[model samples]
Structures are given as C-alpha cells and as structure tokens.
Target chain A: MLNIKDLHVKLEEEDKVILKGVDLDVPAGAVHAIMGPNGSGKSTLSYVLSGRDGYEVTAGAATLDGADLLVLDPEERASAGLFLAFQYPVEIPGVGNMTFLRTALNAQKKARGEDEVSAGDFLKLIREKAKSLKIDADMLKRPVNVGFSGGEKKRNEILQMAMLEPKMCILDETDSGLDVDAMRLVSEGVNALRDAGRSFLVITHYQRLLDHIKPDVVHIMANGRIVKTGGPELALEVENNGYADILEEVA
Target chain B: MGLPADKSDATADRLAALTMPDGASWARIAREAASTRFQAMGLPGRRDEYWRFTQPDTLNAIQPPEAALYPPEDPPAFSALDRLSVVFRDGIFDPEASDDLALEGLEIERLSTATQADFHWAKDLYGVLETRGQDPVERPFAALNTAFATDGVVLRATKKILKPIHFRYLHEKTDSDAILHFVVRVEEGAELTLLEGGPAAARFNKCMEIDVADRGSFHHIRAQGRDHERRAVTHLFARLGEESTFKSFTLTANGRLTRNEAVIELTGDNATAHIAGAAVGDGDFHHDDTVFVTHDAVNCESRQVFKKVLKNGAVGAFQGKILVKEGAQKTDGYQISQSLLLDEDAQFLAKPELEIYADDVICSHGSTTGAIDEEALFYLRSRGVSASEAQDLLVLAFLAEAIEEIESEEIADDILTRLESWLVRHRG
Candidate 1:
C-alpha cells in the first residue's frame, strides 16, 4: 500500500511549489492512474516520492506499507520495494545492463537479509524475462540504455521492474513515445507483473495507456491537486474532453 | 659530497683495466661518448622544451654516486625463480638473483657478454631511433647510466617464443642512479611478449631499443618505479618490420615523479603499432607519458590511448604525436588522451598531434579532461551502488578501454585486478 498526505514540495531556493498539498492513496491489489496536463506536477510527485534531490518536501508525509518513504534515501527506498520507471532512461556508457541489474537486485536482497541469487539463477531469470519482452540477447550485454531506442528504453524499465518485483512501482509517462505495437508490448509486460500484493501508480498525459492498463481508480490532478476520483470511465472522459472540463467541475 | 669521491668509479676503472668482460669493448666506447655528451649538454634546465613541463630540480638534488656492486644488506621481497627474470638492484645487475634462461632459439644474456650473435640480430638498430633533434635535459643522468649500466639483458627471440620475458628492477635506500640499455630483436616471423616492472626507489634513467624483424610481433608491458622521494625517466624506441606488429602498454599506478617516452616506427609496409598507457595518482605524484608513432611505409595503422585519474593535488600529463610520411599512403592513425580529475586540486594536461603528408591517409586525435558525471553518479546511487563504488566502477571502465587491448586474457585480468586494488587503497 502507498499513501501520501498533504504532500507539499518546493524546489530548493525557489518559492515555486511543484507539489502543492497533494494527497493520494493506493491500496494493495489496486491500480491507480494519475492523469494531468503538462506542468500539473505529475512527474514532480513521482520524483519527490522517490526522494530525488533538488526538491524540498516542505510539508507532508509519504509512506509505503506503513514505512516512511520520504525519510529514506533513493537506494533505501528501492530496497524498501519502491521502484520509479523514469520517463527518460539514462544512458550509462560502458556499464553493461546485466551488471547493473544484478547489482541492484543483489543490493536489495542484501538489504533485506535475504540470500543473494546465484549467477546462474540471475542469468536464467533475466533471460526468461528478456525473451518474453522480445529483447535481444545483445541488449543485455551492451551498456545500460546506450544506443537503445526510446521504445526499447521504456521496455527496459518494465523489464527491470519485472526483475526487481517491487511491491510498489510508479511509472512516469512510460508510453509517451511508444508506437502502438511497442505500447502493446509494454502494457503486456505490465499486465504480466500484476498481482494482488503489488500496487502500481501509472502517470501519463494520454488515456491510450489506460485503455490497456485499465486502472481500478482514476484521479484527475489539476494545479498540483487531485480534484476528483472516479472509475475507469473518467480517463475516457478526460481523453475526449481534456483537462478544462475536469478543472471546471473541481472549481 | 666530501667523502670518498669517485672511489667506486676508481675501483671499477682499476678492475676494468684488468679483467674487463670481453664484450665490454663496444660498451666502453659507447659509455665514454655518452659521458662526453652529458658533460657538453649538462643537465636539462627549465628552459629546455621537453623539460618545460617537468622540473629537473628533484633529480638534480639527488647526488647519486656509482654504487659498489655488493650483496643486499637485506633480503628483497621478490625473487627470481624457474621463470627467467633479469634482476637490477640499484640499476646494477645482481648475478646471484638471476637465473639462466634455457628457451630454444632465444638468446638471453647480460650485456657484458655482448656477443657477435647479439650484434648479428640488433647491433645495427640500436641508438638509431632516439628522439630526433630533441635536447636531453637530464643528459648527465643518462650519461651516468650509459657509462655504468654494464650488465643488462640482451634478449633475442630465435624461434618465435610465446612465453613472456620478465625484467625486474629492485632498488634500496642508497642514493644511486641506474642507466640500463636493453636491446631485443624478434627474428623474422617470430613473436615475443615482454613484462618489465621494478620497484626502483631511487633516481633512475633507462634506455631500451627493440627491433622487430619483418613479420615479427612484439608485445611489451612496462610498470614503472614507485617511490615518493624518487624520480624515474624511461625511454623506449622500437622499430617494426613489414607486416609486423608492436604493442606497448604502460601502467603507472604509483610514482613521485615519472616520465615515460615511447617512440615506435613502422618502417615496413602493412605494419601495425599501438601504444596504451594508464596512470593513477592519489598524492602529489606526477606521471607523464609522451609517445610518438611514425608511419614511414604504406598501409600502416597506429593507435595511442592514454588515461589518467588524478586526486589529492596530483598531476597527469600526456603528449602523443602520430606522423605519416610522404609515401606512407593509406595510413590509418588514431590517438586519444582522456583524464579524470577526482579532486578539486587535481590537474591534467593533454596534447595530441597528427602530422600527415599523404592526402589519402586517415588521421585524427582527441583529448578530454573532466570530472566524474554527477548525473551518472545519481543514477548509480539510485540503483543502490554507493558513491565511492560508483566512482571506482566508472574509473575502471575508463581505464579498461586501454587495458583491454592486451592479447592475453591472463595479463589483462592481472592488470585489472591491480587497478582494482589501487582504487580500493586510494578510496580507503
């Protein structure tokens, strides 16, 4: 479960409030979609929740499964079963994807006092997951995101989430640049990982991704605040009518 | 400066007058002429071009006298075993510490025994590849080495031996300057690998010449001296034959003041040469690598890559030049020098040059100096890798590009392990 209470975050040394008194909660086994226009602070909410720097949490609280997510560092949050699928995946040259994934997986395992996975087991798991995603074997050998197409990078983020098997995941605009075929692949990957014990917070500007994901709850966020909550039909309305209609209802 | 001035030299002269090694005749003449050159040029002053980036005061302050060939006052940490290892203590050969190599078709012996067989292979090639028209600022030190560097190894690969030859130099607390000259010839179609490393914790100067006959290949890896108070200057001049290849990898992980000069000439068509250097400095250490690759024949390919990581107010220097002569058409040359400064006070200076007279050639050079990427660090951190660990991995990746050129997997692994250890120590 994930919960945020009156989350207020401001950029360092600036009075501009990126996340203004936002509140949301996602119970286990539920899929939540947060939709808003540009600059509505959807990405900032994810980064602030993930504990990225340059943003000050002036006031508010964020908790995952009753544990303080805001107080933990980025790595600690990752170990605590929080995963953020970045909108723009970083290109890390000379760092092989397999090596980076193994490091992260084992680091979380170590943090949890669990036994580390054997190299053979790790390789097998990644190979199986990568096969299902239609990722070439060479992609695992190359540097992380280096030379990878935009769709490939987004798919890689999903592959990582699958490999990590985190309890809570926040995907930030993962379908922004994906073609219909790539989006189907991404949605299939996300669907494959769905379970009753995990929660996913999908953030996007378009309703196309929601058509495939079919969130259990939809929250319309406007001006850094969630104005309304509705069922899956809400996304279709926003898709057809846009944010002005939602903002007028909230006002 | 007052006690027993030149007593060891006087004694050496008296001994040379009586029971000098038969092969010492040419060495004697060579030594006298080198000494004269040193006296005429004197030690390099700050005004000299080559010495402009480096100061000679540290070396000039060392009043090294000719060492008396004596057994060690204490046991050395390293020993020569079944594998052939040439030992140099204080730049003087320790006959007791060396083993006679018995590989077939290969001739490995001390320079004092300079034989006709040795000259038949490499006599005509020695001293022909010196830095052209460049003044030797430390001429005195080089002259001293030329005069007294009596017994060094003269290795000849007779039948393309693949086994690596190891040269070990060990020095002690004494103030001594060593001049060592090495001549190696890989016969036509032969192959050889040489590993030269030493803990020469004193002022030392070295000159080595190698000739790779037509179709012969040579791989040379040199790990330089390490002493906070010592200075080291080393020169390597090599010529590659037609269709032959010469590759040199130098690792400078520890040193106070160190300079390495590499000059490689591809004299025959279809020759290939590569020079790679990686150095790390965590203290006030200073490391410099200057390499020149000349393409005199057609269809020659040459590459040079240098990487340095400097911290704690250290300095790193790299100067690389690739030259393609008029007729050396179809020459493909590439050079790159990159440095990572880990500390605010660390500094790096890199210069890359390409001189091509042939219009049909491909030549390019690049140099970059920067700190570690902060965004990359954040990404690694977000992935659960600690900051220091991330830095270490990035630095290793930076240097691995050069070290990966080594043909032998074992040697590459060994160098990587050593680099990891050095990073661990510095990070601690």
Candidate 2:
C-alpha cells in the first residue's frame, strides 16, 4: 500500500543529501521493520513522507495507493491517511490536551467530509481508549505533553494514532527513550490496532522492540538504501552480530 | 531653527479656556493648584522622555477630532457580574439610565452634587493623591484632568462591599471632549471592587485617585473598548496602607491613540500589589501603557505584567518601572512586558526600568517582541488544524499569561471569549 522508488532527499538549507536511491515497498496488512545504523536516512524518510518543512525531495516518486503524497500539505497528508509518530513529541504549552485532541480530530473529520465529533462523544471515546493505554484523567487534562515523561509522550502519540486511525502508520524510533515497562505498554497499544487492512512501517535500531510487535518482513537499510530484504530472522542476525558483519559483506 | 515654535503653547491656551470645577472649598483650591502645575508643565512634547515612543500631537490638539461614535460590537465588559451600575453619557451622569445611587457599606455621591458640607471628606482627596504621583516625573495631562474635571464620583467603603461599583461610560456624541476624575477611599479592614468599561468620548482625559487604608483591599478592572477613531489619555494613582492588597488589570482593544498610565505606591509593610494589562490592536491602532510602582515599606511585594498583540501596521508601546526604596528589605518585585506582532509591518517598542535601592530585594524585569513561534505553529498544523486556527490558538496562549493576573476566573473567561472573537474577526 506504500511505495518509494529511487527516492532522493536533501536538506533545504545546506547542500547535504540524506536519502539517495532508496526503494522500498510495504504491502497492505503487513508489518515491516527496517534495521539500520546511524545516518541511514531512516528518519529523513519519515519526515519527508509526513511533509515537514526544511527538506526538499530532489528526484523520484513516493506515493500511497496511487495518490501522490509529495504535493499535499502536512494536514492534507494526515487527512489522506498518513501518520508519523515522531521520535520526540513537540511540547505545546497553554493548549490543553483535551482541546488539542478534539480540534485535531474534528479538523481531520471535516477534511474527510465526515461529521464532526461532538465534545461529549470525544470525551467518552478518549476516556475509553486512554484507559487501556494507562493514560489517566489528569494526564489527558494537562497541556499537550508539556511536562510529560518520555513514556507518557509515547503513549500520547499512540493515543493520537488510535483517535485518527490512519491507514498507514510509521513509527520512527518510538522505542528510543522508552523503558521496558513503557515499551510493553506502547507495543500493546500499537498491537491492539493491528488489523488486516492497516499496514505498519516500524523504523528502529534494536531488535528488542521487534520481539514485542513482531514484523512480518525485515529489511536491512544502509547508506540510504535497502541493502537486503529478509524475514524476522534478519533482526536476530543484526541483534546478535551487530550490523558490522552485514556492512562488511555489502562493502 | 523651527521659527520660534509655539505649537506647545497653543495647547496651554486651549486649557486656559476650559472651565474648572467650581467651589470655595479645598476641592476648588486643589483644582487651582493643579491648574498652576499644568500651566507650568504645558503638554508633553516628543522630546520628552515619557512621550518618546508615542506621538504627543493628538493629545495636544486644540479641538477633539470630529469622530463618529463607534457602534459598540460587545456589551459592557463586566455586565455578566453582579454590580451597582452607574451610567455616563457623553461624560455626563445619566440618572435615568443608572441605578439609584445607594449601596450598602459604601457611600457614593456625584462630584457635582456635593455641597459645602457634603464635600468635607472628598475635598481633602480630590487631587491629593494625584499631586503625590507627580514627584520624580510630571504628567501634564493628569494635572490637566485634575484642574478641569467637573464630573465624576466620590466613593468610600466603610466595610466589606457586597457588590462591585460598575461605571459604564457610554459615548453618544461625536467630537466630544470629556475630562473625568474619580476619587475613591477604602477605610481600614474594608473591601471594595471597582469596574470601568466602554469608550467615554471621542477625546477623553480621565484620572482616578485611590487610597486603601490599613488592612483594606481594593480591586480595579477596566476594559477599554474598541473605538479605532477615539483618542484617550487616562491615569490611575493609588496608595496602599500597611497589609493592604491592591490589584488592577486592564484590557484594551482598537483605538486610534490611547495612553494609559498608573502610578502606585505601596507604603504599608507586607502590602502586596499587582498591575497588569493585555491589549490587542489591528489596523491604524496605537496603544500605550506607562506604569510606575514603588515599594516604600519592608517585606512588600509588587508585580507588573503587560502583553500586547499588534497586526496590520498597528503600533504598541510599553514603559514600566518598579522602584524599591532604601531600607525596604525583603521586597519582591517582578515586571514583564511583551508584544506578539502578527506580521512584519506591526511594531512594538518597550522601555522597562527597575530602580532598586534596597540591598536585600528580589527585583526582575523582562521585555520581548517577537512573531509567533513557527515550531509551535507547525506542531499545531501538523495535527490537521488549519493555519488560521493554529494562529488563533497561539495568539490566545500569548495573551493568557497577562490575562491570568486578573483575580476573578469568571471575568477572565469572559475577557478570553471577547479576545477569541476579536482574533476571528481580525483574521484575514
């Protein structure tokens, strides 16, 4: 359901290329985990897909189900069913968490030509969804991630994803700052949303996270390109031997 | 070089023609004293330090501009709260429109209605506090207000007041010049709240002198209405007794030119005071806030918070100062002035000053002028909110810091709602 062919990206301010000749495809109803070392253009791919500023796509094409994603604005991209769970969630002070969520959910709904969710309905749904994720009423009431723990921020991202329910979800280093318990809670939150229609692209360095949310296909990414595509066993190889052996063999 | 300039003297001639408050008592003497003071000071000039950032010509106009009275878009700011309403139309008291001039635990009398015996206590107060504010700096307009103002209220609180004294200044006539003075005295252990709102006139010069006795509390909140063509200059002078509490907050919307000044002195040990302002201007608008606060007694605290939002070439200025006197040890003073310019054309100018003589005091002041935070804007937009919606949220957040200084949550919420509507209307 997601496609990137010969995708090339670079920083807009400086002449630095981050992505070069990268090609990847994730089929519907499957989970794909990409393992790579530092500077593999993994985070760049996520930012470019989500339409962040300060990045320019130089060549090639990236699309979702035949729709060109490059031309749409970030909000439009979100409405068109693309979600990026940022590695570091932004802190918006003075904007209440509940108010932010309702505003965002209704905005996306209006963009999709659907009925706006009433405040009462939003509160009930958020409460139910947050309960399973271990989010309390106080956390939901505070300003959006203003003084939240790393785990709380991750849980909030998952809450937003569940609320928006986008078809294509990309988790960029969601496991970076999470502890074992927090990781378990986050993985469970993501796993509960897994279905035959929704696809996932999980970009992480460690295979430990893969144990909790198992990926159907594993890809080794290096030098801004997918060097090899394998099954779950590839994650084991990288976890046990580290990417040193694979880098040498590819070189 | 400028051909023996006498432009400033012309305003002095205009003030000479206006009638002064009449009486054979101390009130009249106060007016005569203020008249002499104003005649010497004339009007503030561009070269003067106080009027540096703001234009002084409009305030010195020989005649009030022939402005059409703005049709108000919102009702009086404090209408939702319970209050004793006093109405002024064209700067004249409207008995028919106002409630009966009676409130428990408080004595209210019109300035014009006071007779020889009735003016006994008020005569001592009419311009007493105003003269005290002129030391270290001169406010020619406030002295002018004191010298000529013939209409206002003499209010005194003897005990805890049950309801706020609300003054609704209604503008009905165009090109009207209004000079108003209000004198308030809160006695020992008493409490009082005073609320003022609306555009009083096309050209308005107003001053209020307040005295809070030992252990008394006084609260003042004002909403300067949206009248882009109106020119107004106002001042508030206050003195606090030992252990007294004083707080004042103001909200200003659109106006052609507005200069609001407050001079406060905390004399009583352990007294606390806070003065805050939140103003929003868009298109041909100019608003100024000049505040000076003094701590004269030990262990007293004071705060000054001012925020402004300007857009579409609107201009805003803030000049605030906090002073701690010698031997006023353990004093706490905090002051901040900030402006959120919506675009490049809008501008904000600020001068924040702190004069502290006390060796053991905590005094801090800050000033900032900036556009909206792009990262925060993007964060909101990335969640699917429209650009305009995201900006509105950030603007409200910027103003919320100053609005929080208001003591009453209900009134604060009301003001917030008004700001939201203002933002929506100004969004292009």
Location of the lowest summed lDDT over 10 successive residues in candidate 2 chain B: B1-10
Worst lDDT window (10 residues) for model 1 chain B? B73-82
DockQ of each: 0.52, 0.67
Task: Please provide, for model 1 over A1-251, each residue's C-alpha lDDT reduced to its tens digit, 9 standing for 90 to 100.
Answer: 99999999899878898888999999998899999988989999998887778899989899999999988988888889888898988888877899889988888898888999899999999999998899989999998899999999999999999999999989999998999999999999999989999999999999999989989999988888888899999999998999898899779
DockQ of 1: 0.52
Q: Is the docking of candidate 2 incorrect, acceptable, medium or high quality?
A: medium
CA-lDDT, candidates in order: 0.78, 0.88
Candidate 1 regions with alpha-carbon error over 4 angstroms: A13-15, B1-23, B64-83, B95-100, B115-122, B131-151, B171-176, B225-230
Query: On a 0 to 100 scale, what is the lDDT of residue A180 in model 1?
Result: 98
Clashing pairs in 1: B44-B137, B145-B179
